[model samples]
Each structure stands twice: as structure tokens, then as C-alpha cells.
Target: MAKAFASQGDLTEKEISFTEIGEGLYAFTAEGDPNSGVIIGDDSVMIVEAQATPRLARKVIDCVRSVTDKPISHVVLTHYHAVRVLGASAFGASQVVMSEKARSMVVERGQEDWDSEFDRFPRLFQGHEEIPGLTWPTTTFEGRMSIYLGNRRVDLMQPGRAHTAGDIVVYVPDQNVMFTGDIVEYHSACYCGDGHFHDWPRTLEAIRRFDLDAIAPGRGDALVGRDMVNAALDLTGDFIRSTYRPAARVALRGGSLKDAWDAVRAECDPKFSDYAIYEHCLPFNVARAYDEARDIDTPRIWTAQRDKDMWEALQG
Candidate 1:
């Protein structure tokens, strides 16, 4: 397993690092890129969050092979982001599982998301053509599902909507370990383009009920030990609060989107400027925050054109 880093070129072409986070559990992370999790069960393996392309996924396969010979039976999507689910076919898993809501989201906005994300972060989708098309779940569950990997149990539950309408967490109770997709990040700026800001903190509180000793976050390094785990959660919570609060305040004051964006940057940059992806996420985060604060519960779809327009409007 390798350490995650920040890549500057095509994301699909970037190198990925797979690190063991617990007994038979691994975190596949790229340099400040989206992450995937692997759980090697007694008889088979479960991969959570597929990368963006088959070519990139092969790198994850190679890492998994280095650790075990078990077949990968399932690929679980924590949500329906193109960067996270598009590379699923590469795993050859018998079943691709996702929340029912996630499947709906894929059908509704997957193509638009794919185009938007690829345009925004070209470095994360290095081999863009290698994608077999949008990944769909062969199996979908509502609320929660408990999967048995031989003697081990993996609980896939949607605590609440935070990062997206279909966010989920993979809980390994026996190991006291959890894989929180983009719901919680460590030293990484969270992208909130499709988030429910008001519901996000409550979602975090739901996640805290797990009493996890270790956490494989969506981005950044794996958290080990309770102290580090708390620190990661706290940092993530603070980041979300600091980002959304000011943006919401400005929006409520009838300020323009640019004003809200500038207000948020003024409040958050001093504290979180050094966090990974801070510059990358701020514009999108502010946009979503403004929408949510204005009583838009559902995030507006982000087409490639809309993405560029928003970036130029907020950044330029």
C-alpha cells in the first residue's frame, strides 16, 4: 500500500496509494484525490467507492492482489459522484451495491455530474476514456443493509444527507472501524456542491454513535486511534461550519452570490487556507451554501457549462 499524495495532471493518470488501515481493511487514496475502501472478508472482498476509470481502478486491483487472493464479490458505492462510481466495472465484482436513493440520483444527474466533475478536476480522471460508462448498482437497498463477509459483518447505512442526498457509511463493528466516504474528511477541504449543509452536522452526530477507533476518511490520511479520530471529526465539523455559516449569513442578508463567496473566503481562509483542496472546494462550497441558505433543499444540477459559469463568476 502507498501513501496518498496530491497530483497535478490528469486525475485518472495520477498514481494511487493503497494503505492498510486495519486488519483486512485498506484505504485506497490518491494525492488529494477521491478515496476508495477495501475490506477483505474471509471468503471474498468488498470494495467501497470505485475510482474514476478502469485504468485507475487497475492500480487499486494491483494493490489488493498484493494483500490477498480472495475474489472481489461486491463494490459498494457510498454515493453517486462520478469520480467515485465510474470506475466500478474494473473490479469485476458480482454485485455493485448502492443506496436506492443513490441509484435514483445516478439516473437523474449522473451524466451531468460526470461532465461537470471531469471538467473541474481533470487531474482526478486521468484515463477518462477508460470508463465503461456510468456505473449503476445491480443491487440497491433502502435505509440500511448488513452484509456478511463469511464471519464478518459490514453494515452499510445512510446516517443522513451530508455530502449528498445519498451518503452512506460502511461500518465494521468488530473492528470498530468505519469508512466514511465524503461525509467526513481529514485535513482536506470538503466539496459541498451537492450537500445539505443544515443536515450535515446532524449526520456527523449520527456517525459519532459508532464509537470508531479508526476511520478511513473520504480524503487525506487514514485516522488511527481515538484522539486522532476525534481531531479529524472536529476539524471536518469546524470546516463545514465555518464555510457554510458565513455564506448563509450573507445570502440571508440579500447579498449577491459574489458577496457571499467573498464573505465566506474572508472568514474561512485565515483558518483553513493550508488545508488540502481549500482553493478547489471553496467556490463550489459557497455556491451550495448560498443555495441552501436561500431555502433550496435540493441542490441545482451542475452541468459542465454551469460549472464553468459558476467558477468564473465566483473566482474570476
Candidate 2:
């Protein structure tokens, strides 16, 4: 028997948890599901990573209402993935913030990404109809910017590129808590379909410079305390390096794509087999790694049709 197409086989709903890592920082995570971070300042709130649709976003809003009454003033997008950005409308945030690179990526491939992601994981797109099309950023910065919500400071920085060409991290310097969106996944498998393999570790090194007491990664439970934070960062780095090393070696040797795919699975599965979305992400991750190893700087745009084709070739 063959495996089901990407995430199509995943039907189980994950249990959600809202953990307070700091006085005003919360991590909204669903057992390995895509996570969201909530940052509450003295007067306003900022959401890091919107859910897939407005209907799905309401659940986060409910979570937000449970804690703070401060109006959501901003929605910060770490990167331009449909699952993370399409739910912006539900927050009614006055400003949607992102990096200039992220905005450009959205303008270039947001629609195709929307269709590609929806088809790959329909369960996450439960409120597909409620999406008001592509989520656009109201404010964009070139490198890094500090946002003050009534005196409390939050720094948003583009620490090079990892998961995507325009990945960003939300750092609260005083709280020592960072919301690392997709740049560092916890137990969840790192989705590298749109990633840059070589630059990823350099970006991770950039993130490590922060004096973080806690971290809320793109997926999985939030890590609190320095030891746990370091462990999570190490795990994310290990996953990325393990997946890319073997695949890249095969690609550099002029091996077939199948060889690269096999190399990644052989190298990565032994360690990451229990990680969430490992199976679903392997083929796409290997494909991207292969391209990167072959000197392809830019990631290919993923469309619904391209998704099916790649799955059929590598995972079918």
C-alpha cells in the first residue's frame, strides 16, 4: 500500500495549550500543530503568526480574550506561509507587520502558496471560505524594527533566511522571550520546502545571540528556561543539518533525485522518525535541499499541481 499525499493522511486534531512563558508572553500551541505567539504590552497586543482562516483564528481570539482585554494592535508575520498569515482579518489589527522580503515573497507567490498549502492540508484550512484572500502587510521593514506597545519594547528582526527567504523572529529583550517563527521548530519537523539550506544555520547562529530565557517556536510546546531553550534550538539545528547533509551530498555527486530523497530518509528517519510531520516534510525538504546543493539559490514556487507531481515522484 502507498502512503497518503502530504498531510492528507493526517486527520487527528491536536490538543491545544496556552502557556505563559513570561509576564505578558503566551504561546498558543497545538501538539505539534502550527503554533501562534501572543505578546501583550502595557496597552496593546501583537499576534505573531495568524492561523489559516478567520474562523480558525477566532479560537486564538478566544484565547486572547481569556487573558487580556487590550485590543490587538498588530499582527506580525514571521514568514509568508498561508497557514501562518491568512487569518489576519480576524484579529482586526490596525497594523500588519513583516519584512520587506516577506512582503515581496507574498506579492510573488502568495496565491500559489495559498492553493498549494490548502490542497496539502485541508484539515488546517477548516475555515477556508472565511479567508479574505492573501494577507497583506500594512507595515514592512528592511532589517529590524522595535515596536513599543505603550513602553514595553518588542524587537522584530530578519535574521537572514532559513525556512523561507524572508523569515523573521520576534524578540522581547527585557522578558528574554523570543517567538521564533518557523526559523526554529521544536519537536515538529522543520518544513524546508521553501527553505535555504546553507543560510539556515547562519540564521540560527544569529538567533542564538539573544539572551533568551524562553522560546515559543513555530510549532510544538513552548520552551521555558535556558536549558530547554538551548535544547530546542539545538534540536532544530540538528534536524536541518541532518536532513540537508546527506541529500546535498547526493545532489553534488550528480545523483538522481530519488538518490537524494533516499539519502535524506536514510540519514534523518532514524533520529526524526517520531517528530511531527516528519514523513510529510521529508520529500519536500529533500527536493529543496537537492536544488540548493546544485547551486539553485532561489526556491521554486510550489503550486498545487507541482505538489502532486513531486509527491508522485518521490512519495507516491
Candidate 3:
């Protein structure tokens, strides 16, 4: 290979922040690393997203302990991404829940994704040895489901296909706050390797229609007000559009993958170069955008070998 993946060189640890976005609702963010959300109810707690490893999940546990001693009754996964679901065992929650489609994805490509992501981002998997195996959900829902932690209604819904076909958002209606997975990122780059480029903007609009007061985004900081929530939504939509437009144009015109890459860069680099993981996500985003534009509805599974081949073809 000519050079390593961008995430391979990102070994520096980011500063962690546990910010309260709403009453009993917190966002555990590590700069541009994967973020998690916490919701405390009358008797128990619910976790929105788990980190990549048990060692990483402990940080979220520590933060949860700081504010409340209630037991974690449920762990709600936003999607089937390895970085977000592999750390579930550490929570020791009685109920681990996911969308039915997401569970199917876990059965299909979970192991491949875990291997792919582990190789692509080594620093995120600090405790790979502790992982028993692939994580599975104890409960699965079709489209939407609501759980009550002692009268606190928590709604989990899949607005539409965006980051993935099964992506869901965790909404606490009482607080008017939502925990959007990779569907909505704050200042970080959206990893579109498993995305629906054409359906993403409509998903963004679906989220925006709620007029949320606050949101704990997939990456970056906690949005604590309507203004910040809207800003994140708008910025995330812009990121998706900026990445897909040029690549789609290139692909429809019968351009090569390298040609699509350059076209995407010319359009995205000026606006998104400084975004976290921008360089790391660009190639895969371009390739996926190109594929989707060429009428590939479902994203190809990203195995470790596929990751290498793609990186070598684009980055080598």
C-alpha cells in the first residue's frame, strides 16, 4: 500500500465531555469519536449508543454513575454499526433492543463490519480481546416502538433510510430531545460507507419536522437548544449533499472511480476538509455514492479484505 488509512494515523486521544442536554439526558462525546446518549427515568436508565469496546463503554458507565445510581434497564442501538453495537455486553442491561432490519443486518454483515472497522480504526477498539463475539439484540421492532422507564416515554423510530436502511432515532418526547445516530452529526464528517444517498435528505427533513429542542448527535458536541439542533440538522444535510452530488454526476456521466473521487474532492474539500474524519471517510463515501448513483440500492458489505482493496485502489 502507498500509505495507511487516515484513521490508522489518528491515535491521539480526544478530550471527553459529558454534557447534560436536557433533564436527566446527557451526551457522552469524545471530540470526534463515536458519541453515546444517556436517559434517566423514574426507576431505571436507558443508553442510546454503546462505544466500540468494553474498555470504551466503561467511560459511559462512569458518566452514568456520576449522576445517578439507577440500574441500566435497556440499551438501545441506533443502528447495526460495529462501532456503536459491539460494546453492549459491558452495560449488563436486561434488554438490548434494535430494529428488526438492523438485527437482520447484524446476522448478515456484523462480523465483517467489526473486522473491517477494527482494521480501519485501531484506536477505537482498545479492548478487542474482551469482545465475546458479535452482539445481538434481545428484542427487535419493525418500524417504531415505545418503551417506558416508569412513565418516561422513550420512542425509537426509523424515520427513513439515511446512514443505513435500519437507522433509528431515540426520542424523549417530554424533553423534546432526540438522539440521532449517524443520521445527524454535528461537526464531524458523515461516514457514508453504508448510506442511502438519495434517501438521506428526506430523512433529514423527517427529523427536522419534529422541531426538536435539543439533540445528542452521532458525533461532535451535544446540541442543547433549538438553534443548535437546527444547525446540526442543516450542517449534516449539507455534508450529505456536498458529498453525493458531485460523485453522482461523475458516475452518471460514466466517469471512473478515480474521476469520481477527484470530483467529490473538488466539491467537498473546500467546505469539509477541516471536519473530523473527513479524509478518512471521503474515499468510501465517494465509492458508495458512485455505486448508489449507478443503481446499487443496497450497500456492499465492507470486509477487511474489501477495505484493503478499496484503500489500495484509491489511496495506494
Top candidate (lDDT): 3
TM-score of each: 0.95, 0.99, 0.99
List the candidate 3 regions with Cα displacement exceeding 4 Å. none
Q: Scored by Cα lDDT, where does model 2 land?
A: 0.92
Q: By lDDT, is 1 or 2 better?
A: 2
What is the Cα root-mean-square deviation between model 2 and the actual structure? 0.8
lDDT of 3 by residue, 93-178 (tens): 99999999999999899999999999988999987899888889999998899999999999999999999999999999999999
CA lDDT scores, all candidates in order: 0.87, 0.92, 0.93
Query: lDDT of candidate 3?
Result: 0.93
Candidate 1 or 3, higher TM-score?
A: 3
lDDT of 2 at 163: 96
Model 1 — which ten-residue stretch has the worst lDDT?
1-10
lDDT per residue as tens, model 2, 1-316: 6688889878888888999999899999998888999999988999999989897788899999999899999999999999999999999999999999999999999999999999888899986988888999999998899999998999999889899999999999888999999998888999999999899999888878785899999998899998888888899999999989999899988999999988888888899999998888988999999999999999999999999999899876
Per-residue alpha-carbon lDDT of model 1 for 1-316, expressed as tens digits?
3212112233354356777778999988776678889999999999998988887778889889999999999999999999899889899999999999999999999999998888766766878887878899999998889999999999999999999999999999888999999999988899899999999988888888777888989998888888888888888889889989999999998999999988998999998988777877888899999999999999999898987787778756
